[model samples]
Target: MKNSTLGPPDSEAHELQRNLSNRHIQLIAIGGAIGTGLFMGSGKTISLAGPSIIFVYMIIGFMLFFVMRAMGELLLSNLKYKSFIDFSADLLGPWAGFFTGWTYWFCWIVTGIADVIAISAYSQFWFPDIPQWLPALSCVGLLLSLNLLTVKMFGELEFWFAMIKIVAICALVCTGLYMVVAAYQSPAGDVASLANLWNDGGMFPHGAMGFFAGFQIAIFAFAGIELVGTTAAETKNPERNLPRAINSIPLRIIVFYVFALIAIMAVTPWRDVVANKSPFVELFVLAGLPAAAGIINFVVLTSAASSANSGVFSTSRMLYGLAVDGDAPGKFKALSSRAVPSNGLIFSCVCLSAGALVIYLVPNMLDAFTLITTVSAILFMCVWSMILLSYLAYRKQREHLHRASKYRMPGGIFMSWACLVFFVAMLALLALEEDTRKALVFVPVWFVILGLAYRSMRQKKSEGVQLSYDAD
Candidate 1:
């Protein structure tokens, strides 16, 4: 890890515009918390964990709540800090900032690739003949164009995207409740009742290993939940809105994740759910609303778009931050008059265009999605772990700031350690499956590459300095 003596960016010169209002921040946070994972991947999770998948979601959401709280406190502690990456670089070291900033950028890049692949898969529902890479490539181009307009446009895009997701979940929960109350029976002969949760092999049909299988996909589902922390720079009122957004995680998790899973399982037995299809669509079908299934498909298609949109915004911002710290090319540090990172946005989109190549080569879409998402989850874990580690450092070095800060992390340092332990357990679970283990083996290679890049960049900076001395 190379330590940087460079000071923070000039506060007024490089500051991102605060264009995201309260409604945008709220919806962005909601959009971040709920993603394609719930809309598309829940079927696989339900099949693997049986009805116990509900507990899987709850536990994951619970652990991440503390992570957000730590992030909230850190972002609120200093107005100069743009995001977690900003504060981590300041407290932990320059190396921590360089690694975390770039690692987070790569995390979203991997996630964006997964989202585009998902978009292609979902588009096949409407147009089967279109090549998977076509929709994938088109999505990147479209989002890149929208992102370049202004920061507020990005907020509006997420706003409507999140609205579609929230409406779809609400519709499912309402329809499921109606079916259970009316004693509706599905074509598969399962009764719509609360008993479906435990009666089907007592919620742990596949036993301990089955329960563990849920972690690999479930972790990916929660990958974008930390998007709130990234918007601290663009938020109109960080002191009020940031805390409000972070504290609402429990409610959103319960409503969007926990309740949605329970409702779907109750309407359609866990055994009847197919791992390869969207459970949301299957639930509407089970309820005899076949026409509504198409609408559900459309909602999920946009859900993938939403997640990918977020990936573009996050990756560009991370690159901008990295550039400001001298870790990346200074061209990326130049923001447009609109205060959007135009160069950074284009660079990320160009890299994201490779999602098309991955889709073209992989042959099997499911295998491609699995490999990409698993690798993304691993990289995100590294970013999350860095946030927790930064929190520990903040406690040790900035105790006075912690005491004086209005938004302090609850459970203090103990919860931070516990979250770290929980992440290790999730990694162990990911290692259990062959496909996921392959991704696990490949994750460290990214860090090694990053290390080499950092060393080379450091050497170049040193050479430049020595030449200046010789000339003098």
Candidate 2:
């Protein structure tokens, strides 16, 4: 068996530096837990499922926490493995790595496009006449330049971006609590109170079907939750920092996702939440804050920037891993002097720039955003399932390692199967909605393309081997 501690043959020449400290990892994990979906997508979730959206976020978070644990344990099991792709390749097969790596790359590209579109829309809040492509392309260019610097620069960018999100959510929760305490009434004459959660139509106001519908959008909110796993190669002290970051996911979700939604619902009631608007903005606006729109717009704008930044960072890293394993083009494996994968970053940013075109090409922005996000969510679930499957393989093949590991997954194989089942169920739920169902149907085409590419890649490799033998 290949040594788990060993990297690629040329790792000495080009390796990702371990520059991300515990603080960077922690903030990155926090940023991943609190995604742009919460800021921009929760309004629709609330409208569809009412207060039950809170439970949807919680359930998704709960399941994903186990996925993170599985990932953390597997990553810690083999320090040489940069991301889930490495382990999936090692434990499952080359094809597993190929599919997971490229799918994850595509997943973030799709998501980054959504964020790009969102950033443009948010920019329009301030500059109503500005072309959507202007802000969209500008964002891609800015992130590319920043990411091209160093891994630490990416860390700092995410750190500050995450800090902004943290502050916004905390402020929203605190302000909403104060409003509830003082019996603050909105302009619509709705009293802010905890009872507001169920007072209008009860906690599961939309019934079981509405609650089920929430999972589709709510799952997208956690798209980047496992983003910390991608930082294993760059993070300092994997054993300590990786576990620390993973363990805190549950708390972060409760505070950032559940509490923030609760505050929004309490402030405006779910029924009053404008489906197309941000409930975060609606909460403050309904509370009579004159600058609420601009404030939340800036926050959500930064929130989208943060998600796009993460997408850029993770996609490059995954590409670096895939290239090292010979799944992607070898060019992506070359790291800059600062150990940043410049080639992969450029490729990802260029793909993200396509979002600018999406704005012009797709006449209906809402439908486009929905399709993009749903596809992203589906692809993310596939990646998450791959991680769990990798964990299961680790437990079986590396039973001794599992027995000796200091950080074992909470429920071990049992939880792994449970998480897999949960993801399968979520996929079924996707079929119930027309928008998500369309994305669901569209996703199989990606797999089909990957299948063809993998076959061609293998055929070329076999022919190259045969040619070398003939020369010998």
Candidate 3:
């Protein structure tokens, strides 16, 4: 029964407080699992995969469950470890920690940028004249102000943000069900039916390539699902709350992702769901809701803002962890009076503002967004791969720990390998698209930068030793 504000007993050396309660953790998990990926990106996915996109979500969720289980077991095995970055560093090596921590930070920055960009685009729905970057920059500032507060405040904010997503999805699911049952007719004159899932093109509407493309887009929706893993140091009762959150992934996927997709497609044919606009918004309009457009618009705006808020929180924590491990600047290690990583939070927000410049520089915001998302997805895949690798190392080097642990990854080593292979397959799938292919090409540039930075730090340390010897 330790006081959460005091943090874990072994965490006195750390500045972050364990102020997140079970309710906060649970809602954070739900919110993290749901993102604008569903609201904004689903249109493109539906256009590509057709109704089969439903299965894409389910399959990805199934595979990622094992990944989450691996993460959970690793976190529980060592209470001192903050997140996957710490475990990866501990189990694998310092290089693994550096790479995972910074890469994860980059993942969120890219995602945050995308979310901001999306916010600006969504804003144009009502205020068409306002520069897109204005809203994007404004959103970042707002999130930065909120995140500067105590960790409990962050939890509260995320709790409500996630609740909004849950309510929106529930509304869509419930409304779609009623429509299907009542055979609701749309403005397009199409009758609502579950059979719309298959009748159009037998699942592969555009062909194998189209179905394959779904994997590329759908994977992004599950990006923030691992946000729960990052809460290891911040969550109270990790043993109980962490398991509750991680175990609920399947249910969340089924209800929020799978059922929502099914509901949308049932109300509107997959082919008819435009790729350029949100299917959720489109569905409400077709359902004859008088204020459908405004309602969905508000939901989507908040959804993007929620994702951006998460990005700021995650990037700051990752930066804090990196600074503590000497992977990043020492200043990021400093926490505010409230125990929040104030410096890291500000740094991430500053980087996030670059998205506005991107919008200004790149005439086609859509292309910029696609590239940013692809990059984020690639970086996240690498982080996920590292987590799996760390698990394998743990089993080999710390087998006794596994035996003593209460929570264990199901399917064991075999599933871990399978998940790795699946990730590789996803990278290949991502490469199929022209835009995403560019992301794969650019990923190595980051590793090159890290390699040089590591070498320079090593050289500096060597010089310092020489100086000490001369003085002696």
lDDT of 3 by residue, 304-345 (tens): 888888889989999888777767787888888898989999
lDDT of each: 0.89, 0.89, 0.87
Tens-place lDDT digits, model 2, residues 1-472: 2322266637466678899999999999999988888887898899999999988988999999999999988999888888898899889988999999999999999999999989988899989898889999988999999999999999999999999999999999998999999999876688989999988879998799999999877888899989999999888989999999999988999899899988988888788888888888877776678999999999999999999999999999988888877778889988898888999999999999999988898857677788889999999999999999999999889999999899988999999999999999999999999988999888999999999999999898789889999999
Q: What is the lDDT of residue 20 in candidate 1?
A: 94
Point to the candidate with the largest lDDT.
Answer: 2
Candidate 3 versus truth, CA RMSD in Å, comes to: 3.2
Poorly placed runs, candidate 1 (over 4 Å): 1-14
Score residue 84 of candidate 1 by CA lDDT.
Answer: 80
Clashes in each model (backbone N, CA, C under 3 Å)? 0, 0, 0
Candidate 2: the clashing residue pairs are none
Q: What lDDT tens digits, residue by residue, belong to model 1 across residues 242-297?
A: 99988999999999999999999888889988999899988888777868767987
Give the Cα error of residue 329 in candidate 1, in Å. 0.7
Supply the global lDDT for candidate 3. 0.87
* Global CA lDDT computed for model 1: 0.89
Model 3, runs deviating above 4 Å: 1-14, 465-472
Clashing pairs in 1: none
Instruction: Give the range of the ten consecutive residues with the poorest summed lDDT in model 3.
Output: 1-10
